[model samples]
Target: MTGWTAEDMPSLTDRTVVVTGANSGLGLEGSEAFARKGATVVMACRSVERGESAAAEIRGAVPDATLDVRECDLGDLANVEAFADGLHEDYDAVDVLCNNAGVMAIPRSETADGFETQFGVNHLGHFALTGHLLDLLRAADGESRIVTQSSGAHEMGEIDFDDLQHERSYGKWDAYGQSKLANLLFAYELQRRLGNHGWDNVISVTCHPGYADTDLQFKGPREMGSTLRTAFMGIANAVFAQSAEQGALPMLYAATADDVIGGEYVGPGGLFDMRGAPEFQQSNEASRDEATAERLWAVSTDLTGVEYDFESA
Candidate 1:
């Protein structure tokens, strides 16, 4: 895997893949790659109209692409449940789930559930979604994968159990980091739980797009009405970041590479992991703390009211 690219991905004909935040950036790139490899991609976005437009663009490129556009607003638990329910009604099994949608460094805000926007949508939303779909993923005919998108920002994160929602105080970057770190914690802990429950057919993996040029970098500035900051970020993206398609290599690799094992983290392989091919990487120590993961899992279940039915395994 020294120089792996999406072209190296194995054929996924007959497979069903779900991608959240598939309207643009890495999500759209990954969805297109999966479609090119003969997989049926379910584009899960917050807006059905935008999703359909993205699907149209994909079909314009990959004429025979099998695609579905569905509404999945991670900021709302009810919306996520409806999305998962629709999937369950339509498909018996899902070959892959890419927890790729997220918000970053925006002005302080709360989700529909009253949880911090970053923590709620980035971590808890995906957490509940995974729980809702675990059974269908396990029912897949072959090995199935759940790829959670994390970030390098996680290194600076510390899970503040006392202020998980940043209720008392809020720092946009801090909240974003915590949520990304939670992604890693959840991914690793899910793999462990799957192992203990004897569910060998499903594996959980984590990946990060190392400093890719995506709309995410500009959203915060735009939201804050800071044209200067937005322009600065645009300059940074142009000068330092890799293309979204190139940045999506790691998650695609984690989802499709035969050698990828459960509980592994994948990211860019270049200097400082900012660009290049996909490769295995290691996260900070806090991200792997089992005790923290367990507590977070319990709190997440309590908050989202979604429980993993591991007993069935």
Candidate 2:
């Protein structure tokens, strides 16, 4: 997979792809790339209006692109369930599900379900969404892929089981790191469970966009009303980060590449994994701990109340 780009993606005609946070940044770029390859993309955005605008923008460029815009607010489990219900009503099977939506180092806040915002939306939300749709994914004619977006911040993470929600104390970056780490744990655990259930046609993979220049960096600072932090992040993005399209390559590769198997992590292969072409990479050891993954999975299922029906496949 040396120097792999979106142009290297195989045809996705007749495939269905679901991309969360599809309105902007890596999600937008990935959605456009999938659409260009003839995949029927389901833009799962928090805002239906913005999702429609993004769909319109893609249609302007790729006239034949088939797109559907749907509302999926990850912070709210009810909204995620509704979104999945709508998809189940419409499509018999989904070929790819990109767990791309996430919040960065934002101020400590609670989601609608009273969980920490970053962990709630980033990891738990995707976990619940995947469970809700796992059956449909298995119904696909061929192998169906679930590509989840993680981050390099995961290296600094340690799952605080005593306080998974960070209710006792909250450090913004630490919370973000924990959530990102949960992403890897969830992805690896899901892959293992699918294998144990003999569902080889379904696979789960994780990826990270190394220092991608996207609005995600600014949102946290903007939310905290810290102009100085926002400006610093902007300068850093300008100097060190790659474009969103370039950063999205790893996710696209994980989702569509023929050689990609379950449980693999994809990321940029440059200095410190900050930028470059997509390649197979390794996550931190904590992310690979089977015991941790299994415990996290149990906690997630209990928290979200969405259980995977492995036998349904």
For model 2 the TM-score comes to 0.99
lDDT tens digits by residue: candidate 1, 1-313: 8878889999999999999999999999999999999999999999999889999999999999999999999999999999999999999999999999999999999999999999999999999999999989999999999999999999999999999999888999999999999999999999999999999999999999999999999999999999999999999999999999999999999999999999999999897999999899999999999999999999999999999999873
lDDT of 2 by residue, 103-171 (tens): 999999999999999999999999999999998899999999999999999998889999999999899
Root-mean-square deviation (CA) per prediction: 0.7, 0.7
Q: Against the hidden true structure, what lDDT does model 1 obtain?
A: 0.96
How does residue 114 of candidate 2 score in lDDT?
A: 94
